[model samples]
Target: MSGKDKPKSAPDVPGATKAVRKLGDELAEARQLHRLLVDPLLNTVRAERLRVSVTRSLWFFLACGLGFTTAGVQAFLADGYTTADPQWWAAWLVEPAFAGILITLLRWEAEMLARRLEVTAAVVRKLKRLLLFSTLVMNVIPTVRPPDGHSFNLGNLFVHIVIPLIVFFLAEVMPVVQEMCTRAKDTATVPAAPDVDLDQQTDEPPADIVRPAVAPVVPSVKLPPTVMTQVRTTLDSVRSEGRTPNVADIAKVVALPDNLARQLLADLTPVNGHTVPNI
Candidate 1:
């Protein structure tokens, strides 16, 4: 056929052509939107931002430790070992510093334990909630108020500071701690059982099971002549039908076999009982 005389395909139809173009345009627009959403996550700036955040956190704890340690040691050296110091400034620095170190270590140790247990994330959330409650209680009670010492006023710092800082450290170290704990747990466990002894053979095949032969006692069942004749006729009919009849059917028209129907039926049934009636 000539090209002009040939039938046009669905895409070549005027309405279908417009629908295809519209669908293509929509798909392109959706693809563009997806790219725009994902681009920010893959950007170099975002990667650098994450790196800087982690670095800053490490430095922050290090700085805090150094500051508190320096203050404690300096104050202890400067003034003699009395609670009531003549120099109030040294007392302010020293007491709070000691407290800060103790609190920080407590947090660090608790988090370390949580991480080792592989429950850091769960423990952190619980600890944060607990710390917040503690902070609130401390704020409400004047005697239990936190000491004021550094630029980081821990009086209210307990509310905003320690809990979240501990949580961050816990998050950072948890995976490594969990891995170490898992390794330690595995090492501590008893080893698995070795393979079975292959030299010895198992018992013979199940189908070849050797049962002791017992001479069966044939029951002396004296059937009436009429019943016997009816049985013979029914059996013949069943044989002609090419299927064994059930015990119930035999009982209705004749005498049931002296042997159990299931035992006799198994021998007579065609197609392994599929063609026979079951009683």
Candidate 2:
């Protein structure tokens, strides 16, 4: 078996060529799918969800930071063993540390808004309630007792315990009460959009002319398809004619009450064929 007997290193096998061809086909199929599929809307929704989630997480973190800052400040204020010459830097540092937490939260909140997320509205409401409760407690409790003469009695009912409880109640419970009131009003007040008079805009025109039509102010009454289609046509007519359509015309087309027609129109007009902001 000399060099000649080795016989030209066995002419590149058929199985190897077939395997390469199969691999190429699979790769082409993958690329074809990559080209044909569209995912921008799904990606957009996912991005929005992620933005809201991150905003919530940042607030939760800030809440934790607030707890730590409160504790740290309490300690600094209550430490009784003072130097003959007080440490001005350590005393000054406490104020700056609280300021840093506030500044970071402000920046993060700004970023959250830039993302077009509505998280700040809810957070602001909560913060206001907390501030109110804290102010109320500070007024009621003239002085906070210091524990061990080295730390403030943040654990006591009058300062830490009772104030936090009030804040929690205002932030959490008051919103529920407000929502219930809103929903109750909606139940009584909601009427069909077709019944709405476009000629008489609401108490005020929406801030943005092109703003999506407001959701129906009323709730609870669901319209059938025939009624909904009629409402859309009526709106198109109203917009085209530059005058509100007659109640009789709407009744003839959809057999709906005038109020119901108006409500339906209100809900569907500006938002026709478009998604509006959730808030």
Candidate 3:
């Protein structure tokens, strides 16, 4: 076959190559955006939701356990008394009263701990212990005595002992959980500082003139007439006192922030033998 008769290779399409390169660049940007912005936001929201869910679950379980334990205590107290007796009815109120006080104290402690405060009062500790001991005694005494003719119930005794202790420990640990969840939520919700790309920075001097950092001024807002008058009066007084008008003098007189005072002084003062227009 002649060399000229052989099929020639297809020429490279510049447009196809450029389009592929553009698509790759866009994909890379999307990935970068996800990593730098979207992912962190999603993770923070997820963490906040998890904390809320766990906190609610803890409270739900605590309520259920406390309700059951209160019922047990009521049963123990009312065991020997007949339903017709007023004492049997009064027994129901006894455990609930103690439990209510204990719960109130625990809630107070949780609030204090969540605020990073300590409940260091000796009375608080003593009172909490007293309430817990009272419930334990009421619950356990019935199990050991077993109402005369009945045999001692080891299972009843075990439950009565374990449940009260569990309640006590739950009361103790819940405050710590509240504190942790509050702190974690606060940390997650805080805006993160943008990550700086050190590699993109250069040592080369900028072509534009560098200016000293100043507080940004909003164009839509102007200084009040009263404030402008006060500033002008203060400036005149400072000049009369044989002192050069400055930011400190203006700030002291007008109670303005240093940056605002500085901006005001610049605006009101004459420059290069020219009078500045009133603002």
Every candidate's lDDT: 0.46, 0.47, 0.69
lDDT, model 3, position 57: 74
List TM-scores for all candidates, in order. Answer: 0.22, 0.25, 0.55
Q: Tell me how far the alpha carbon of residue 269 in candidate 3 is from the true structure, in angstroms, after superposition.
A: 39
Q: What lDDT tens digits, residue by residue, belong to model 1 across residues 1-279?
A: 899998988788777777788987787777666555444234434444543465466556745643443443344344344556556346455534543544564456544542333334676566544543433332333223323442434454453344434544543453444344333332222122223333344765346555456844332333334433554567669778987577765554422343643343443346753533322
Cα lDDT tens digits, model 3, 231-274, are 67878888889888988876543444445556667776768956
Worst 10 residues of 1 by lDDT: 186-195
Say what the RMSD of model 2 is: 20.6
Candidate 3's C-alpha runs over 4 A off are 1-51, 189-193, 196-279
> After superposition, which runs of candidate 2 have C-alpha atoms over 4 Å from their true positions?
1-16, 36-38, 76-279
Point to the candidate with the largest TM-score: 3
Sort by TM-score, top down from the best: 3, 2, 1
Rate residue 70 of model 1 by lDDT: 42
Q: Which has the better TM-score: candidate 1, or candidate 3?
A: 3
Whose lDDT is higher: candidate 1's or candidate 2's? Answer: 2
Q: Name the weakest run of 10 consecutive residues (lDDT summed) in model 3.
A: 215-224
